[model samples]
Target: MIMQSLRGRLFLGLTAVIVLAGGLGGLLTYQWAFDEAIEMQDSVLIQIGSVLQHGAQSAPAETPLAGVDSDAEVVIRELGTAPRGAVADRQLWGFADGLRTDSLQGRPVRLLLRSRPDGSRFAVAQQTAIRNEIAGELAFRALVPIAALIPCLMLVTALVINRSFQPVKRLAAKLNARQADDLDKLPVENAPRELHPFIASINGLLERIRLMVDQQRRFIADAAHELRTPITALSLQAENLEQLLLSDDGRARLASLRTGMSRTKHLLEQLLALARYEMGRPGKSPLVSLDQVAKDVVAELLPEAVERGVDLGFEIIEPSWVRAELVALAAMIRNLLDNALRFTPRGGHIDLGIYRQGEAAVLQIEDSGPGIAPADMARIFEPFYRGGRPSGDGSGLGLSIVKRIVENLGGTIAIENIQGAGLSGLRVTVELHHECDARATGRQQAPAAVPAES
Candidate 1:
């Protein structure tokens, strides 16, 4: 997981290198310094031995040098020519006149033996322990800088890597902040030079996607436009058949044909509606009253509701305005009311509400009917997707169109089954952002809870 991040990988790799180099260099320098110090101490012993070789030397019997180890002082002892009873003294006498390591009074010491001009052999000796203590101190001082520098270099490396990757972070942040409708190409000028090719490739892909979407929308609209005339003529021909004398069976079949044709025409209109919004043509004048649109749709649809023996009325109303295209908003509300009317059994009731919810204008409509199945709820908004519930005289594009319109206007719509109240029903809620108050325009947006048309 640590290797997944570019910064982490770089930091770990560089830190490892810095630590390894410091550790190895410190080890090598300590070894070199220790050897050098030892050699210098050996040279001091040789110099003292040479001085004693040219002069008369005598043994200091029954007297020992004090305060030598406390001061890190070399233990220099002279062993003159005498019958040596101690094994260490015998071993020292057996050696040739040069520096060597041997025991002195049962302790380790470096011995440099020399013969003076008076024919008395002399030995200059220093404790090996005191020499090693001085050498270790010098070597440790040499490694201090290397030990301290590794962490400092690691910190600087982290800062440099983070700064270098800021451009990538900025690019990601910009992409994340864009709206779904925003398809503009990302600017490559401010990005790092190495990222130019990648950015250009992304821009090219976006252009292709934009062109593809445009073609798809244009195709649907053009096809719908071409089919409208023929479908209108067909409707007229079907109506003309209604005026002709025919058998009862023929009349029933004729009615079925007309119903199918009407559904087809409505389907085509829905396809055209979806295509129109897909092109993203939001009206320039976006200030519209949500409550007024709902009222108008209710008034228009009331006669149909009456014919179906359904009861429709508003539960609450308020001056709720939104920034929206007038026709699209009307289409959305009409579709919602139509769905409610179609599924609602004869004599069922539909309750509508329009009110302000914080910064949003909310539209809530609930119908007392056999609500849609829970399993089919997720796919209810898909184009031409009919659910398991019995849907009468619909192309299944009504909710799809409403969804598209709501999305295009940057609003939200949610449908859920009504629980409790011993009623099988569906409740739909839509919330649209309010950009300005309708009272400011003095348009008398809507009154509260007016009666539904009978």
Candidate 2:
């Protein structure tokens, strides 16, 4: 995942470089500063030694360098070339005139030994640990600023990286939010120069996708039209054959052929409808009577339901309106009713309703049939996705067409089990933005056709 995101990788890489460089640079700088401080301290020791030789101060006292800078831990000792005082003092007097490393009181010290004008020997000494301590302090103080700047640099790096990748993030969001059917070209304006070519390539791909989708819809439309003529002619010929059928077996065969022909015709009509909606429809939406649309579709399919011994009627027919194209609304309701009537068993009941729900108009259809399986509910709207067990004859495109129509009309549909509706069945509820087109034209008429059960 880190590798997949350019921003994350760049931020990490840059941070690693900053930390590595800062650490190395800080160490090198400390080392160099320590060395320089040591040299300067050595120079101080030499100057003090030169002054002492010129009778600058008497240093035969018991304490270490009393009159010098308090922080400078140096001890001036007097020793005679006779090598006569203590064995340690005699050992110190043995060194020649210059600076040397020696031990004083069993501890390491930097000693500057010189012969005085009267030939007496004197030593300027500083403990090695004290010299190193001073150098280390100065070096660490010098490194503090650089250390502080490292965190600041990291913060700046993060900010710059985030800002630089904003365009990519924005582009990703735009792509992710786009509908699958939306093949609009990506916008390149205001994008970074580095992403211009990438944006252009994406736009080209979108154009190709748009063209492919258009061609597919057009082909479906053309194929349905081309098949319609022959199928109608065949239906006429089949009717003519039915007039002269001789035997029962032949009649049965003819009936089966007619059934197949009817199913084929229905399938072709569904395909054409699907193609028509997919190509886009309804430039401007007007007020549509939701209750009226549902009633008309239910009425059209009433004869079929009656033949199947299914009771189909409106349960709640309120005066509800929606802002949508009338044709699209009719098709959507027709498909839902058709599905319900097909699935319902003999003597089963189906319910149609329309009422105001919050800010939308709700059109609900409930059927007394086995509801969809738990697993297949999510994918029922997908085209041709017959569930694990398809119960009825269908082109598998009915619901697909209905879903497209609903989306084009800016409505939402949901299907679930009718839990406590006195039937183990499926319930479909469609919600669309409500708009009362004619509030003045009151609908006091109870329902145009509410059956005895309602």
lDDT of each: 0.81, 0.83
Residue 218 C-alpha lDDT in model 1: 98
Query: Which residue pairs in candidate 1 have backbone atoms (N, alpha carbon, C) closer than 3 angstroms, thus clashing?
Result: none
TM-score of each candidate structure, all chains considered together: 0.75, 0.75
For residue 274, model 1's alpha carbon misses the true position, in angstroms, by 0.9
What does candidate 2's lDDT look like per residue over 77-118, in tens digits? 888656777877888877888988878788999989888878
Window of ten residues with lowest summed lDDT in model 1: 445-454
Off by over 4 Å in 2: 1-28, 35-62, 67-72, 77-133, 144-193, 388-392, 436-454
lDDT of 1 by residue, 216-284 (tens): 889998999789889989999999999999899999999999998998888888888878877876455
- Residue 336 shift from truth in candidate 1, angstroms: 0.5
Error of 2 at 195 (Å): 3.9
